[model samples]
Target: MPTHGVIRRFNDTRRTKEKMTPGDLCLLAHFYGVSVEVMALRLEDLNLLPNGNWGKLKAGGFRVREAQQQLGLGPLPAR
Candidate 1:
């Protein structure tokens, strides 16, 4: 689950229709059920990023885990 602050941030970003961030392309492509190749992401990899947050499998397998914190997304990929 997401924290209140995380939820608030999501809402604010949504309300503002801000520009896309690093991982947004992957998620939006997933949502639209389209190819993610432009983002250099495979459609199958979407499974490793549920709800737009890196899953445990991906967290351990990719450098993205480190980016999560660097990007202020949280420590445990619980975002």
Candidate 2:
């Protein structure tokens, strides 16, 4: 999908302004152990996993809020 169209579609379905970008896609690919092409296609088709009552977003890249949960990672302690 075109960049503009992707943004528009993302906005339409998402209630928040936080939409995935190319950079995010790259990270998601790494976290999910998938190719960029696969991730991008999933984003474009909105079929990465599945949609339902759950707040399962097919978003690219890891949002700051979900970084830990998505990757089972934790934030570093403050010095």
Best by lDDT: 2
Q: Count the backbone clashes (under 3 Å) in each candidate.
A: 0, 1
TM-score of each: 0.26, 0.36
Candidate 1 runs further than 4 Å off: 18-20, 23-79
lDDT of candidate 1 over 1-79, digit per residue (tens): 2235334444454576654344554444333344333222432243322443334335546454354445454332222
Least well predicted 10-residue stretch by lDDT in candidate 2? 48-57
**lDDT digits (tens) for residues 49-72 of candidate 2:** 343312233343334446434655
Clashing pairs in 1: none
Best by TM-score: 2
Model 1 RMSD, rounded to 1 decimal: 11.3
Clashing pairs in 2: 24-61
In candidate 1, position 43 carries an lDDT of 22
Candidate 1 lDDT at 78 equals 23
TM-score of structure candidate 1: 0.26
**Cα lDDT, all candidates:** 0.40, 0.48
